[model samples]
Target: MSERPNYETMYILRPDIAEDEVETHTNKYRDLVIENGGTIIDNQQRGKRRLAYNIGKHREGVYVQLNYSGDGKQVGPLERAMRLSEDVIRYLTVKYEGQHSSLGRSTTPVAPMESSAPRQDRDLVGAAAAIPAASDDD
Candidate 1:
């Protein structure tokens, strides 16, 4: 059997939706992922926030993020369901090569580069004297 890859999905829902409905929607998608042979590692609802610009005439949206592990075939059905839902404003899924500690967060730190060569200062006056200047007449 092929190994499942890690994935993260972030979706936006219409802000006008009821609070109870938000939980319902979140649970629905979580169940969808599990039903499609995927494991839900984490899920979060960021609450309603004003959009940078209106989407589908909506000025605000509720952000939802989910992290899971699944095979390639499992993604299509979940995405399709999101697409068909009128409550969903937008959604995106990204597959990651390696494991992540948390959704939208990176734990590793980058190493600094080292240079082998050292810098040296030179006499600009001597270098300038070595080159001859052109005459204006020429």
Candidate 2:
């Protein structure tokens, strides 16, 4: 089998849309991807959240995140549908390069090195000790 490229599509829907209508749209896109030869990895409804800045007159939007793997042919149709939908305030699909951080993947935290101490103070003290005291004869 060939290696398929992974992609993540995040879209913002109009906040005022009904919950059932949201489900309809979500299922529509999910089926669309499958029909276009893409396999869905994960689909998440991030729920309604306030936008950083107002998009048009709306202060909040329903967020949907879709992750899939395909041969890159499914993007055009998927994005086209989103572009034509009035309920979709914004949409973006990006080709995932490597390990995605925000996909609920657990990552080991990096521990601080044993020598992780402030060096500036030690350097300053050594520099002061190295310098000769000013003589009155000078």
Candidate 3:
């Protein structure tokens, strides 16, 4: 029998958003998962907190979490939706293999894992890429 796949995604919503708008944004992500044939295991609200630094000039956010079961193929659509959503300030989805991904999605940092990869845009390019053209009179 093929093994089932489970994944979890955490995202932050705009703190200034109206209550009705919050529900709309939350439902959007939920529907995305449902439409993709994935089961939503849980939807958690972590509440607002002060940002470490300003994000869009906002000091707080409505944090949320989603636990789901889906194959590798489903990850992309969910990610794309999050990216396009102005209401969602940031999102990160990680596959919790073997371990139970039961907790509500929150803004808190997840425990570091060993072999997973980081996104390419997060990397620092070499100095050569950063160096400007050497203008010269010499």
Candidate with best lDDT = 2
Model 3 local distance difference test score: 0.79
Output the TM-score of candidate 3.
0.69
Error of 1 at 62 (Å): 0.2
Q: Give per-residue CA lDDT, model 1, range 19-93, as digits (tens).
A: 999999999999998998889888999889898999989999999998899886668888898999999999999
Q: Which of candidates 1 and 3 reaches a greater lDDT? A: 1
Instruction: Report the number of the highest-TM-score candidate.
Output: 1
Clashes of 1: 0
The residue ranges of model 1 lying beyond 4 angstroms of the native Cα positions read 1-3, 108-138
Q: Give the TM-score comparing model 1 with the true structure, all chains together.
A: 0.74
What are the per-residue Cα lDDT tens digits for candidate 2 across 47-101?
Answer: 9999999998999999999888899889999999999999999999988654445
Candidate 1: residue 99 lDDT (0-100): 57
The sequence of per-residue lDDT tens digits that candidate 3 reaches over residues 1-138 is: 776677888888889888778778778888889898888878877778777888887889988888888776678898998898888888899886554534443444568878668655534566557878887878
TM-scores of the models, in the order given = 0.74, 0.72, 0.69
